[model samples]
Target: MLAAAVAFLFLMQSAPAALRSATAEPRVVTPRGDLAADERATIELFRNARDSVVFITTRQRVADFWTRNVYTVPRGGGSGFVWDEAGHIVTNFHVIEGASEATIQLADGRQASARLVGVSPQHDLAVLRIGGAGFAIPRRVPIGTSRDLQVGQNVFAIGNPFGLDWTLTKGIVSALDRSLPNESGPDIRHLIQTDAAINPGNSGGPLLDSAGRLIGVNTAIYSPSGASAGIGFAVPVDTVMRVVPQLIATGRYARPALGIDSDDEINDSLKRTFGVDGVFVLRVEPGSGAERAGLKAAARTVRGVVPGDVVVALAGKPVSRFGDLQARLDDYRIGEAVELTLLRAGERRKITVALGAGTE
Candidate 1:
């Protein structure tokens, strides 16, 4: 062993250049040809859709109890996209729910102050506007319809998940028409479920189809540890198209209603009392469209105060709960007449009622 070590040392000293040449050279570089068609498509999609995404940072003003002085503290943020060239940015309502101010970080690394345009907490959507007039977007996210989306369709999500800006994740549509509730908002129905890796900062980001078109807004993830669980939900773009214009115009979603009053809890109680299923109508607005349409509410009869007209369906769509009915009504607008199927005295009848304004 000693002789071998001495010989190796002597060889290193005698032929150090040969040893250095053997050890210092790197492996030859291999030539990788052009990317596959699917890979090229994915790259093209990311390049085209990236500019439409933005990173949002929010701040909240807090007052010190001892000095009574207010200070702005950094609040958590989420992702959004450019709604128009007018500098209107759209994000999840919960992202800036209690924020006093927010900052918009564009894809080109330019920061701009933003103002809240409006919010729809029920839908979990909010809009912000930059003070730029006729701002032109270098790239626009192609809007696509979500009503025809099917399970197992390729979907892409671009966002700033975990504060990592402009991150892209790919997955398939895990499900459709999914309904889930947020702790801060009402039950959101007709959601598009994807297996995409959506985390906290990914909220309000666009969920695009294979053609690089906006299909849904990445909103919530079904995670117990507040991280990605492969089950993420997004608000459908169809709902977005309906709610955003109203929000931009009126600062709130003027959801169409029928002017009739009812409650889910009351409906449940009435279901037991009257031995039927559906939303029980408590009262119809006096001289309203519902009353004019001959809609009846629970009233006093010779036997007792029995259930009146219980809504079973709307416009050929079955409505089993109050939220179901609420979600169905969102598809219509004010003054639009829709067929309402009701259960009157254990008999079924359909009536065409013009919807009035409703509060979701």
Candidate 2:
């Protein structure tokens, strides 16, 4: 009975292993299959979109150490897209930064010198006009509203990354209504974030929707490696639509400004010292709205008068940072009246200030 029981236990273990092996199917290799519907659609859009995109190169004079002479050098490069039939191509201002010369390279291997007709550093936008006629620049991509973009919607990006021309990448919208710093402005607000691959030279290129509409301008990406790590940002189409028209019409963007020029930034130290949470007024411009409204700049006894107005709120919206003021002004036109909450003489007061044209 002991021998029979030991044999039965061995059979149970061996039988299960044998049965498992018998049931396991052999690996089979198959040929590569066709792309799925979404992939095919992406490919089609890329083909159509590639024609509209172009590579921009800017040249600057650099001193050559070896030759001990100054010469023109390729300063930098970025992407651009056809804007209109008048030969206007739109790109980022930073793309052409320090550019003594600008040129556009088309997908068909046609290179042409371009003229910088307009540049708005405040908006990071520029317009380049191609020389010579008869080149049918691709259609002005239909602009889609970015205000309705929901998180996780698929997004597509095409640009010349690292000078590698015409690259396509896909991802989803990671966020919206983001704020970031700009070279010309205090901060760029209401930016759109995506996981699409945006890298160097991708700036100023179009970020498109699934239907191939121009959604935003691929501007920046968040990556330490300087490569796309599933985090990218873009300037929304609404801003583009708003800025480009004036840029093309006039050679520069003229934003309405608040006549009063005061410090826009406020920090914790400032909050504790000043006992306020709104923007700390550095100085109220003479003959400006703040001055006209009897606004006084904050003063310190030891500092011998560092006088400026601290902005606490604008039209009921709290102003914690200077960017808040800039953003609020961006939404309004010139000659608009806005209510302000000012902290003067360690006391809070409400005042009205009329916005005027910004410095040209």
Candidate 3:
């Protein structure tokens, strides 16, 4: 038996190499066909929009409590996009709200210091300028109209989500004219809602259309886990188109106002008292547009509780909340005469009032 086993081993050792090992040959490659049209379109969209998107890093000034020394520390970062050929960057106001300084990284691996140009906290938008000697010009994103956007249309979001630089996420426009609560001021109005996987670092990034045109600025997400839960919001480009140009021109954006003083809490109280829903006029600014238009304020007279003019509509659109009034005012520019439907003495009256500079 031992002699027979030795003979078998000797025969196996002399066998062919293919029989001794599993690595005989490589498998045949399966060729992949050309990319689908949609895939190609997505790739082209990212390619065209890549140069316009920028990664922003910010630092915050921190003070030593014991030593009383102030120094800067890395605060946070988000995304932004080039607005024009002049190196103007448009981003969310919350991105650089308390930032001491910021740096912008371009697509070509170049970094430059950014200076705040202007900001509209109410709109959650800010404009920054970055240019010095030898700074290369950035490609401005093609602007698209958000007012004409339709639900379920293909939308692309280019941002640096979770510190992943220049990441592209695609989804459809889940909805439009959405409003999100903003800590800075009034609720952000006319936001374009999408399911584009926008995360923490996606804020201020450009939300592009299928044609690679900028339609919105990615702002916030509706997530409880601090991650993208398939719901994201962006400031519509129509508001961007109006606010960015004004931010570039002026150091501050002056929102158009009716020049009437009103409060939400007080308005709620008035609503309970008067049993009506609208912006309750508490006080009208002297010599202002509302005053010139004969808008009256609530007064405590000897006759009893004299009700004020309750603004109910703007340009025929019903407005029920103070935020609604502010949001509606955003649709028109200052100095433009807009029709306001007021509820006075339980009767509806329409008045044309020229918008004045906002005092917010």
Candidate 4:
């Protein structure tokens, strides 16, 4: 056995040099600081997407301690981006709200005066126009389809959080179709939630995908101390696309409406009295589609409480909440007709109501 082992060791020592070289090639390793494919993709996306980001500044006059009118120092600042070559810049309504003047700070550090082109306080989005030379508008991000967004899919956000301009953050889709409040009282719907770090100045910035397409507009963050707490919300690009074009053309988003105000507040007593789920008919506008369709409202007479027609559906769609009605109605253009399902006099009836221009 000893003689056989010695012969085997001698043979191993005499192995071919080409065999050893081939084995060493298999151990050829990359450098330690090399980035993974995903990390490379992220860096590339940020580089490509940062150019579209912009900084917003607004100025307003305020009375000093002397109560004299003076030029107030610039205070309001946020993030926005170019929406088109027409000089329409999209940002949060809160960013430049109550400002006398506005400016757009381009990624190249050139500041240009901008005008409030249009605003939709209901959706918390605003459009500004910078009509001058020497200000090269960045590429407007093409709107991507957000309806197919899946959880765990990567997303990127570029904003000027905490006055830090063009800060890029990446994360996965945390949630979707969330509901958040706006100036119109929670009328904004179809929000996109992300765990990405969205800070104060991040509002009105773009939320991009791996392909760097605009998927949403960073709007709000859920935080106890006004800083990012791992939860953030963005206005879906679909909604922004639907409103921005109209805003560019007319400086306002003209959505269709039923021209009637329904009782949005639902109490136990009201629900029990109406024998329906948390909805009541408070009033119907005269000469409106609701009135033309013979829709009645609850009356307060000397007798017991009377219930009017209960709207269970609109346009063959169930409306369990007031915001649902608003969300559905927002999809329709002005002057479009819609059908409504009403329960009146213990009988269900369907009526077609032509939508009118929204007063908003």
Per-model TM values vs. the true structure: 0.84, 0.83, 0.88, 0.82
- Residue-wise lDDT of candidate 1 within 1-360, one digit each (tens)? 999999998888898574565455778999999999999999999999999999999999999999999999999999999898667888999899899999989899888889999999889999998756555554557899999999999999999999999999999999998887444434688999999999999999999999999999999999999999999999999999988988899888877778687777767777888778788888898867799899999887898777889998888777757766766777777999989999998999999988888664
All models, RMSD in angstroms? 4.8, 7.7, 5.4, 9.9
In candidate 2, stretches whose alpha carbon ends up further than 4 angstroms from where it belongs are 1-34, 63-70, 263-275, 298-303, 306-308
Which sequence of candidate numbers ranks them by lDDT, best first? Answer: 3, 1, 4, 2
Query: For candidate 2, lDDT tens digit of each residue in 238-262?
Result: 8888889888888887776656554
lDDT of 2 at 132: 69
Clashing pairs in 2: 257-358, 264-322, 281-309, 281-310, 297-308, 298-308
Candidate order, TM-score descending: 3, 1, 2, 4
Q: Quick one: best TM-score, which candidate?
A: 3
Ten contiguous residues with the weakest lDDT in model 3: 179-188
Give a tens-digit lDDT track for model 4, residues 25-120: 456786788889989988988887787889998888777768676776786888998888878899988898899898788887788888888888
Worst lDDT run of 10 residues, candidate 4, spans: 18-27
Query: Residue-wise lDDT of candidate 3 within 1-360, one digit each (tens)?
Result: 999999999999999987877656888999999999999999999999999999999999999999999999999999999998889999999899899999999999999999999999888899999987777878899999988999999999999998999999999999999886654456679999999899999999999999999999999999889999999999999999888888899878888888887777778887898899888888898878998999999898887667889998888888777876876787788999999999998899999999999844
Local distance difference test values of all predictions, in order: 0.88, 0.81, 0.90, 0.82
Count of backbone clashes, every candidate in sequence: 0, 6, 0, 0
Comparing 3 with 4 on TM-score, the higher-scoring candidate is 3
Worst 10 residues of 1 by lDDT: 131-140
Q: Which residue pairs of candidate 3 clash?
A: none
